[model samples]
Target: MLKKMLKYLSSLRFTIVLICLLGVMFIVGLWVPQQRLLKTVYLEWQKNTPNLVAFLDTFGLTNVYASPVTITIWALFFLNLALVLWQRWPVVKSRITVTDAKIVDPVTASGYPFRACYPILPELSGDAVFAALTKKGFTLRGTTEGFYGIKNRLAPLAFMLFHLSFFLVLLGGLVTVYTEFIGFIDLAQGESFQGELGRYNTLPIPKMPAVGSIPKVSFVVQSIEPKVTRNTVTGIDVKLTDASGSTHLVGINTPYNTDNSSFVFKHLGVAPLFVLIDPSGKEVQGAYFKLDVVKGRQDTFRLGDFLFTANFFPDYEFKDGAHTSKSMEFANPVFLITVELNGKAIAEAPIARNGSMAFNGFHLEMRDMPFWVRFYVDKQRGLSILYAGFALATIGVIWRLLFYRREIVGSVREVDGVRCLVVAGRSEYYKSLAEDEFVRLFETAVIGK
Candidate 1:
């Protein structure tokens, strides 16, 4: 019973079922926000939706692939492939290397390509029939008991290669799911970060060994180039320095590739520098604040015992009794600033370009605003394996399409005191076409001539 189970597990139907299950799992994973998201973003999501946080925590939905369900599915699929390959290896390998062909069974030979009881000339011997077959350039691999003719014999390897590539691709994906690291890097135009152990942060909320074998990389944000329309940051210029001291310019979609890491662009938004001073004219707080995470370019922050709120309007408008930005560009920039203390509104007014507000013994001013971009740094250990899978799959598919494997077998046999040559043909695929070609070749090369 166990043997029968093993056989079934290695069958094509079993593999198909496992793959279908994996596909469904992959779709579900996509629908659920993955743990692969930025740590701050994911945490913010959980914080904002407490009920969803409980649900995701209960079933590990946030970390779908790393969860038990997905991992088990992948493991089973891998096992199915390994077993199927183990069972099929001998057949394909032998077909590729076999020099002498043996007679096939009646069941196999009786299919589409066959001719039975073809008469031998009454005076001609069986040896003469084979000599005729040889004259037709059959490339005989037969002893007179049976005759074997083959063309493109090695093409069967395409089947093996395609299956092997599937294994490689899946293995690469599994490795990446388990060990790959994706991180977000934030910087001002002139800011930079080192790629060392102490200088970076990654998503999936960095585990016990924080650094964890990540490749050393460092980069400085140079400048961000704006898009023509609306004048937003479309691309960025960066200077990257690897551990080897090599400096390279990087930009959006143009990542610097190292042995195991890739640095890609992720987030882009605006940062407005603001400074606040007490009534005594002494500076209190100053820094560049990001507005990307805050929807509608508005956010509330607490400083000292005061609550400060900023409402940004890139192109100020009060049309149709609605306060909205006409465009994303800073055409006529305006900020509506409001101050409150202990839930009581102290001051509220719209501040224009080069704006300032003085209220409740504090002075606030907008200094400058600029665009900044974030980079998604990735490090994968099995990228080579993934590339190999793609190459092999392509080669296998092309070979199968262009150079299919086929063979014809014939034998001189006497039945019921009548002697004749019995012929049969088979192909790796495209059976009907192979059969038709076999008949035409045999008739033209031997019988007709």
Candidate 2:
């Protein structure tokens, strides 16, 4: 039963079917972004596909790569490839005879698709020919009747190696699906942010076997300097302590790399600090209102039954009846605000930096304009595994393509008073190329005087 199962799994037809299914699934999966949780996917899809939300969730289509069914299919693929490699290992071993082969028929090798016969010099010694083949990368073993000789002796190993790499890639992907942590958090300049899992809105939402422990991380934004030419950050300074209790400075484009986590700058924008004072001389709100111009139709917030919306300009300019900024530099930063209470318009006017407005018993003031930086945090455990797999795959490809496995079978046979050599060669694949290689060998080692 085990043998039958392996045979079925390792069959070429079965492999082709599996690959086709995976290809279709890959196309389908493109509709949903990778590494995002199903909940997030559902939310995004519901905007135009409210009815499909239930279907997507029910079928695990949102997080297709990490879905239980897809993972199982990938696990099976890995297993199948492993079994196939194991089954073919003996064939490779037989072709590369460690002991002298009883019958050497290089030209008739079943795996070698092409064969050739060549003439040789009468004075060419067997040892000399052996030396030439060895120099050209061939391992020779066996007697006349059962000899085995091959160039690129480890070519079969490359076949196995490539398959092994593919398996590791799948396993690595599986590990990433379950073990990696992806989250986004925003921090204002001089604001502190924590790295607790609870503090983050992580993606690909943990499903099975739970996740490994994540390192504790926290950092305070020190300062932000924008590049006025393009409204991008020139640099952002952040101060954090290492595990050794040493201070380190992080900046934009400079990633903070830890053992298992990485913190990289995502973006930086302005945050306007505000103070809202209610009646009875009580200070009600004193905090930064994060103004993200990239978020939606309006940048707004609410405090004490009052809603606020604003159009901001770093270098204020009114051009052609449209709100525009003269430059990214904050030479004359101002904002046009619209305030509403219970859906009734309260105020609409332009306010400069450090400006204030009072209505009834409440007072509102913009104290400072501080830039906020958002860093995307990633916790990865299988990155090394994925890279290792890629490296191995590259080695296997080079070995297989650049140095293909071929064989030359020859023994000196005395013919017509002059002792001459009759050599037959074969190629495992790339028949035409191997034929050319054999011809070169004939001219260089065999027929050359």
Candidate 3:
């Protein structure tokens, strides 16, 4: 049973199946809204599709990367690759091995897969043939009776490197799974984030490590400037102030990285600060509502049974009883707000910046419309290892494709009473190309050919 299992584990078909399984998991991960990465989106999805969400949750598909099934698959993949390398190591080593001082006896033309016999001058010795092989880029290892020559001796190691690269990639993935943490945080312009556990929009994944690894640093999003290209908002350039008061300009492509964590731009939206005053004149609630709204779209939130729906107009304009934005620029901004109580529309009005609207003896004030940017923070330590594996894989591909492992044995022997040089060569790959090279080597070394 052990032998059979090892054979299965080391088989090429088993490796391909594992790769296909990983590919399927990757596709599933892309299709499903991962709860760890987008908690709010996942929650909304769960609310709308409770049955589907339940099925996904039961199978751990919602958090596929952190799922036990995913971890098990990775573990099995690592085991299989290791077994394959182990099973092939001895054979691969034997093929690539060469002793420089070992002598090889001369053989006839029929001895090798590709061979040629050339008549030489009587004065021309075996040394001449050996010298010709050396000048033709073959390393001469011995010249006792004949000569043993090899070229691209290290090319066979490329096969081992290919497998080792895969092993490193799997190891890197395992490292990331155990040590990495990801979370999302939103900070409106001028607001500060102290890098606390409670500041994240959703709790970070792998909560235990996140608690320890999160950088104890604070920074404020000072301002945001959109990078416009051809009148389209391509990205944003953010001015940030760190705890030390040093400022940095960051954007979607360039993240603020520190303490093994990176703050990458996820998205941007409008945040309207609101102050709700009760009829008794007490400040009941005051907070910023980070509404995921864009041009012509509305977003809403609720306070104690009263729902507030708001649509923002940057560069606000009103003509012919229609409210719209003249452009994407924030030259002028306004919010058309509606209030509903118990499913009945109580009030509706368009409020300018810092304007107030009233309904049912309650006052709601729009303090400001500040752009908020969401940052995806992650502490992923395995990235360097993964990059190294990729580098190794690239090198292996180049070496294996560009260099061919070949061996040539030449001997100065007597055939039918005529002194001749018997040249034989073999290549593990690119047989035709290697045969052409063999002809070139003999032509270059032979004085009479």
Candidate 4:
């Protein structure tokens, strides 16, 4: 039963069918928005068609690559390739080794696809002919009749390399899927982050709980600079210092990599520090509120039975009885705030940076506006193995294409006192090119001399 199962799994038909199924799944992946990569887009789809989204998510169709069914299929594919390689090892080994007993008859081998027989100069010796063939990269084994030879003898090993690469690539992908860490966090300038799960704003679960451990890394953002074009942030540059007091520059596309983890910039916004003071002149509560307000959009929060709706204007302007921002760059920042008590508006006004306002026996102060940036941190596993697989695949392809397997059989015969050399050759690949080479060997190695 085990033998039958191995044979069934290693069959070429099974491999082909598995590949076709994976291709279909790849197409489905292109059509569906995966939650991990495009949360906002997937959320939009969920909002638009909740029923369809729920069904797809339930069946794991929404995330095809990481789905249990797809992962099983990948595991099967890897097993099939491995079994196929093992079953074909004898054939590959046979091709790799050349023995004198196997090619004892040069006369019979002369009938090969590429064959030649010609007269040689009497002065030419077996050593001379062998030396010529050696210069042309042929390994020869001498026999009673003549010589049996092969060129590019290692060419057959390329197939094994190809199979090994495929196995490694699958192994790497599986390791990464089950053991990687992906999360996001928001940090204001001067705010530090230690590698802890609780500090992350969003964390995606992995397939397995074998993520090893989180990297020992800590960094504080020193400053943030955004390159704005037409009131839109085109790019963001951040300077940060690590726990070791080393500073590194990170940007939207340039992430800071350390301890096999990468810190990538995702989003940026304004975080205003607010302090609420009571009538007794004592600080009631205080914290930095990172609001997602852009272009005069209102964001609301609750503080001690009071609702505060605030709009942020970087480069504030008061024109035509309306509040607006001239640009997205942080300059002359101000907050247009409306405070409500028991759902009734109590105070509505603008508060500049470092300014204070009073309403209903309470004072609210805008302490400072600091830029906050969101970072998507990733600690990926098995990337080195994946890259090694790619390198091996490339080497296998180049080896197979550049150095093809070919064999030669040669004999020295005498007819009517005229000494002549007979040589025959054949190539498993690139027959036309090998034919030319065969002719050249016959002419230059024997007849030409």
Output the number of the TM-score-best candidate: 2
Best-to-worst TM-score order: 2, 3, 4, 1
lDDT of 2: 0.69
Q: What would the TM-scores of all predictions be?
A: 0.73, 0.81, 0.79, 0.78
Candidate 3 lDDT tens digits, 1-449: 99998899888899899889888888899999999778899999999999999999999999998788887887888888888888888988876778753344435433357788877777776677677677766787766256778888878789889779987787787676567767788888999988887778754543435334665668989997765443467778888999899998879789998777888998878888888888888877878888877656789988656898888877788988988888876667788888999888899988876898888889888887788898888776787888789999999988987886778877777789987777788877667777887787776676732
The models' CA-based lDDT, in order, is 0.69, 0.69, 0.79, 0.81
**Which 10 consecutive residues of model 1 have the lowest summed lDDT?**
203-212
lDDT of 3 at 303: 68
Q: Write the per-residue lDDT of candidate 2 for residues 1-449, one digit (tens) a residue.
A: 98887689998777787788788778778876443545555566677776776677677776787688787787777777777888889997875555654335544545555444445565666567666666766676754333456777777778778878987776677687677666666677777655656655344332322477564676656666555545643555666565455666667767788757777778666788878788677878777877775322358888778888877777788789876778766677787778889898888766777897777677778889877766677777787788889999999898877777677666655546555455667776567777777778755765432
Top-lDDT candidate index: 4
Ranking the candidates on lDDT from highest down gives: 4, 3, 1, 2
Give the clashing residue pairs of candidate 3, or none: none
RMSD of each: 6.0, 4.2, 4.5, 4.5
Q: Where in model 4 is the C-alpha error above 4 Å?
A: 1-5, 38-58, 102-107, 118-126, 143-145, 202-208, 228-235, 252-254, 274-287, 293-368, 412-421, 447-449
Off by over 4 Å in 2: 1-6, 32-41, 44-52, 102-126, 142-148, 194-198, 201-209, 226-254, 276-285, 294-297, 303-305, 326-333, 355-364, 416-418, 447-449
Give the per-residue lDDT of model 4 (tens digit) for 142-254. Answer: 84258888888988799889779987787787787666777778888889888777777744542222666665689889998777776877888899999999999999789
Q: What value does the lDDT take at residue 49 in candidate 4?
A: 100
Q: How does candidate 4 score on lDDT?
A: 0.81
